[model samples]
Target: MGTHRPRGETARRSRTLSGQIARVLPLLPLAHLDREFDYLIPPEFDEIAKPGVRVRVRFAGRLVDGFLLERVESSDHPGKLGKLDRVVSGEQVLTPEIAELARSVAARYAGTRADVLRLAIPPRHARVEAEERAAPVPIPEVQRDDGAWQRYQHGPAFVAALADGKAPRAVWQALPGEDWTLRLAELAATVVARGQTAVLVVPDARDLQRLAGACTQRVGAVVALAADLGPAVRYRRWLAALRGDAKVVVGTRSSVFAPVSNLGLTAIWDDGDDNHAEQRAPYPHAREVALLRAHESGAACVVAGYARTAEAQALVASGWAHDLVAPRATVRECAPKISAPGDSEQALDRDPNARMARLPHVGFVAARRVLAAGDPVLVQVPRAGYVPGLACASCRTQARCRRCNGPMAVAASQAMVCRWCGVTDPAYRCSACGGQRMRATAVGARRTAEELGRAFPGIQVVFSGGAEVLDAVKPGPKLVVSTVGAEPVALGGYGAALLVDGWTLLGRPDLRAAEEALRRWMAAAALVRPDGEVIVVADPGVPAVQALIRWDPVWHAELQLAERAEVRFPPAVRVAALDGSEEGIVSLLGLAQLPADTEQLGPVPLPASSPDDHEAVRLLLRVPRSAGSALARSLAAAQAARSARKIDAPVRVRIDPIDIG
Candidate 1:
């Protein structure tokens, strides 16, 4: 039989041992051009022209930045190849696994690999890179037997599975009063004991700080990665993870891609937190990325949160992961007593003033009692400003600016400011009824504090939100009014919590409004002492309120998952949203090939801010979970093909957008 070489092999081999280069061109992030280009490596620069090294390449008659992905002995290209300009850096900042991950993430979100790489790796800082390397500090080993894990039904098995390198997947339902940071640290230590690395990704810096402290308490040291740190410190921490010097990495969203060598476990805290979602292209959620990394690297996965997301519940439903939850008695013991006055019609009838009052008389009385007992009272508000919106007092009509017709709002010093156009009107007349008087339509944290301060003259009123958010507060008999997601932790848990304007939070147009509201409520409530009380101003009969009253987030999440499945929404299925000029979006959708069972809705016109602005449309495409990968691949291919033809009119394609509205 005649000897045959592998496909794409050159029949006439080069005697010079010519090297092929996979150049990651730093050009416009066009879908069609989102791939590596083949280049010939010159003989002199052959040693430096390797994969994972940044290089300057001559493309389109200009020197552009690029990353060399791979080197080969031959090329299949019929045309003459351009030689690499020069090697930019010897440091392999783009590791092989990360490069592969970037590509995979790009394809998954129908985005260009370059865009994903931009977020994956920060800009190269020569000074930071040249700094002397310090030996990674060793962390103390945690006890093999943990008393906390024993309290949960499947926590011990989950810990054991990870420690034994079984690569188990779990959705940890965090108990209200439990120390999740310590629990997560214990899990990381167990994985480290197996001689494997672990990654813990939280939602923000506050959580990162707490988790880092937990790691220090359990282990000797932890590599914390956060944007708030100086560039030098942040880069050092990142390098530690890349060089495998850091066995345990704790950070926010970006740390999900930390190049920990031999990753054994990846855990995300509060997966439902909007902060976990990457705002850049590809927009990969931290939970999804961790799950993907775990799957690819054979690492165990843990998605833990007080209130789980529907997406996580979907994973448990498919048997892809197990639910690790505490017993009912344990939850009850840890959770505070919860009540909803709106749930009972008799309670509403007995005190009609409490129904519309921001701080109902009953709630005010409860707060006063809690303050009298020398304990802090936490009041959760929905907005942050003094008065976010205003309306005409006489006709109760929304006040708008004459210049832009934008809603008028209260700025500093009771000034009437147009929120949209930034026009200030100290003396303005209402366009609707020619009324000069203006009143607030929505109450904010500052306004709530102002009123509460007057109501309780002797007690102190502390504000905890907006530009000045606090991480921790002293335990005192004070009223701390904070907006959602900005509630500060008390030294000891707050004695009482009042959740005000629950309707404003739950009545949003978004699909996850109730889910998000429940999460916010639970997060605030979790800060209350076990013996304390949480009074919700919403109706008790509502599912979200009931969930809070019963302290059963798992039930709420499961119910949400079921509802989404019935309605063919996300998590139950995969969804992608396309947005752009009406014609551009329509054309892209038409050109793209989708799965056979794909269902599509819209080309629906989206509301424009001004009449002069161009009208944009949105399209939502759905496919079964099994077909998600196929659909993503098809969309990426279509986009790449379109980009290749230079047909770009600026259409945005996002997969599983959190704000579908």
Candidate 2:
């Protein structure tokens, strides 16, 4: 319990008010401090102190900022209430819809309302809001059917439903190299044609730029919102949406919460991308947020991705959303020809020399043929460095730094570098075999580019990775060596592609290792023309590789969902991760009063790059999906109890954390 102010009685009697104000203090989300407290509205400040307005109040004997939720005629308290200190902003930044959504998100994630509100509402920019707000502008018509959307079975119907004011939910599996921006623009235009607004949320700024272009082409122009914008600019954009000035908003993750009036549709591009997950407390995912918004606003929902996640599949399976995918023949026609390790037996037999090299001789032949036809070739590598990981030449023991036990790799000038602790060793020796010689365990893009440069002789080698990324490459006889997301888009699509180091990507310890690898491969392969060939140096027997070769992400997602269900992993079951001091976690669990059926795992130390004075461990709590809300409530209750008792020792809670480990 908080301490009562000595002058509280006097302060209450100093003001005569018609109503009490429900205000929530803007403090760090300490559980017990989460609720709203009643304050007597001073007669002079009565007009300004209203719901959704920012106010200052005295809390725990200190002045703090808060948002006024509502004003009521009277309070249920037997004791008199303290008067509101002052009004901060009369402009209602926190709209009723957004406030409710924030509350729901907080409850769902076992997070404090204040923390969720912090993320939901941006900093108050008075100047920006005071400026003349823009109004929704009329949009031009866009071409609907032009080979862009004809591939999907439900593509036309999805657009029609939005235009007809029918709230349709769909899980769209976009074809490789398909124009998602164009597709999203068409949907927005359909909604606009019906005199309604739409909110489109993508994973990153690049996606935002592309979607913005599409929206501009189809629906005139749209308001853009993202974290990278200056505070004033971001707030102005948000205000436009809140004021119904913008009918359509295209942006990154935060755009899901954009207050577009009469929202007819909410779309998320690449829901599987990790960028969609908020890093703040509550950690709401964009896809789930959009779904919630769609349901609340009676708007249509669209979740599209190149590679589907199990969660999205669950939505389709549960009939909550229809699966919008291209027909078999269309997919086969659009997808590049894929050849896995076993599938390339004929090519290897034709050229024995190709099998002897890492790049593969068949890949060389394909490169030559594509270059002759004046098309660039994209080579995808798993890493970007001279040498990413190394091992002892004699015994194959993984090279590690002696000081920090971090995995060691060779940097420029043959100097050994630690991937974890940044330690360096010029004269490193093997611990197991006492051998000084080292071997490359995994080759990186830079090294791969070097090898290819020599093999291909005079042809230009364009390296794209790290900081230097190319937006779009011109059609030429060039070899573009890039790592995963950094792969440059060729002007006319790559003539051929080489997906190397598949084993390195799939062998990561993370749960989504194989799934993510397939996604990366698919993204790169999608850049290749339909007539182009994609040579993957991975065993065809692997499910991920087979899925890639067959161009069936849906099948792979289904298989993954089944596997997760069997193991009781997320999407099958709801999970929460609590990371903190061992003592703090144990205390929290004891007081949490979680569901009886909830399963708890670990107090295991977190994997750290360097030794710490105080060890940090994490606790995982899982319950059946049906009882998810119950679990969250119980945890929240426990947190509140801890805060009330002043027992806070710093515990971090994350719901549906991306990295489960």
Candidate 3:
């Protein structure tokens, strides 16, 4: 063989080659590769690289980051490639299932493998060292409450199917008015009793805080993992779960991958929230990630909210999961009296008496009635600050920074600062007309709080929004003004709730605008007393508003789905493509090669930080539901080709986007 070996072949075999050596790596999927390079793998690291362990490599002309994605027996160059620089850690960072899930998600979202990996796993520094943590103490099991057990019995068999360490996946739709939070807590307890860990994902941190308190009262030693946990503590808690120390995990979107040991149940509260979608790279949604994790680990999956999403509804219609419902009579009884301003002829009148705060005829009247009997009222606002931004009343032109195009806000000293981009312009001038006169269009929580304080003279007015002012606000004889996601009221609690300024929420340009608005309304409404009244300050005729009026979320979702189906939007059809600069986007679009039924919507204006940053443009492609998987594959192929080309332009792709503004 040596004598017969061709000279060219032998010479070629001796040359160094650059490319990813391992078949798999533990690192996130969208890692950038500045240049191709060779890496030597030591014999000790060989077994670890079988596919998931962390490895060190010399990349990009420097010792940069790289995941050992896979292993190969020989190099394509036939020449000698350098051995891996070193193995950073022996721990298997990527499991085969996790890797597959990441790939699927990456393909679906038109994202790079590295991007999906980044979202699935936390940062290396964020991982807790198992050795540093003490073993979890074994506590005496408490007797199950009879009432809770009975409620658990009412859930479908699929709910208990998760106890068997199989795919415990179920899509549950709770009829409006039922106390889902209390039911979810009971489900958490049931899962915990089976000697396994559980993860509960809510729409925001406030919900997490509320659920955390409930879980702590129900089960001992519950750990809350939210971004609010300053870096150090968050890392510590994250490590505890990674090391199998903490069992119960409750948090917002990012907590979907919480590393609870022997994972049993993964429940998502209000999965329809746009907050549940990661706005960064890969753009993987928390709902999809949870479903994938459940499928992979045989963990129980529960998707519950006041209103069901089209995707969830589709799952139920397809018979993939069971729909859990409260008796219709229970929903009818528990649902409070909901009325909309639009239903009344005087809704359009600007009369102060028409205002819920002034007339004491709508929510205010209900609040007074409740308080007369000694109860609290909850008010939900959409914005946080006194006034987030200012605009010209004549032209409706917002004051923006000349350099950044970011909305300018006057924060003390009359100084203008861009809320985004952080461009501070001491002397900001309106570009539209060089006008300085600006008026506040929407009143935020701070201003609303101040207004309520003045209006309700003797009654205390408390504010709860971006700031943690919950402690300053007591429950009785007061108006608790708070932002939507920042609502601080407790469960089974508020005597009455007023949903103000429906226009602000419905006016959003996103596709899920109505869905999100309804979720916020329900979350607040659920907090009110069963006999309480929910007065909404908007035309009740609007679908979103009317849904609240009748407490008929199912109907609203159905109508929304019908509209989506007609337009080929998500849950009806699938859309995917890379969004970037003219050339790169064109290249990506060309590579996508859409099918006959599939359509291309735009290479149009993407949400940009500024009008001046024109280097980036968005391209969108829509695929029929039947061709979605194929389209994803084609997009993935395009990505691989682009990566091989080492293109410089940044491209971002998101599948089934929740926000299409």
| TM-score for each predicted model, relative to the true structure | 0.87, 0.87, 0.79
Supply the global lDDT for candidate 2.
0.79
> Model 3 reaches what TM-score against the true structure?
0.79
* Model 3 spans with C-alpha error above 4 angstroms: 1-40, 43-51, 68-78, 125-131, 139-168, 173-182, 216-222, 228-232, 260-262, 342-361, 384-441, 468-473, 490-492, 614-616
Model 1: per-residue lDDT, tens digit, 58-135? 767777777888776655454466777778877788888788787778777878778888777767777877878776
lDDT (Cα, tens digit) per residue for candidate 3, span 1-661 = 0011132343334433343355323232433331123355666665655556666655434454556655655444444455666676766566565666766676666666666666656656524444467767553364445453233324645545544445555666565445566667666766777788888998776678778877766665577888777766776777666666666788888788776667788899888887898988778889888887787777778888877788887766667666665556666677787887536557446344453332335655676777686677778888754342466544445565565333556655676765433456777667778777766656577777787777667877777877564633445676888888766654346777888866556545345667778878887787776788888876556788888877777678788888778766778888764567888887765655556777665455444678787566555577778898787667766666676667666577677776543
lDDT of each: 0.79, 0.79, 0.66
Q: Output the lDDT of residue 433, model 2.
A: 83
Q: What lDDT would candidate 3 get against the real structure?
A: 0.66
Our model 1 lands, by Cα RMSD against the true structure, at: 7.5
Query: What is the overall TM-score of model 1 with all chains considered together?
Result: 0.87
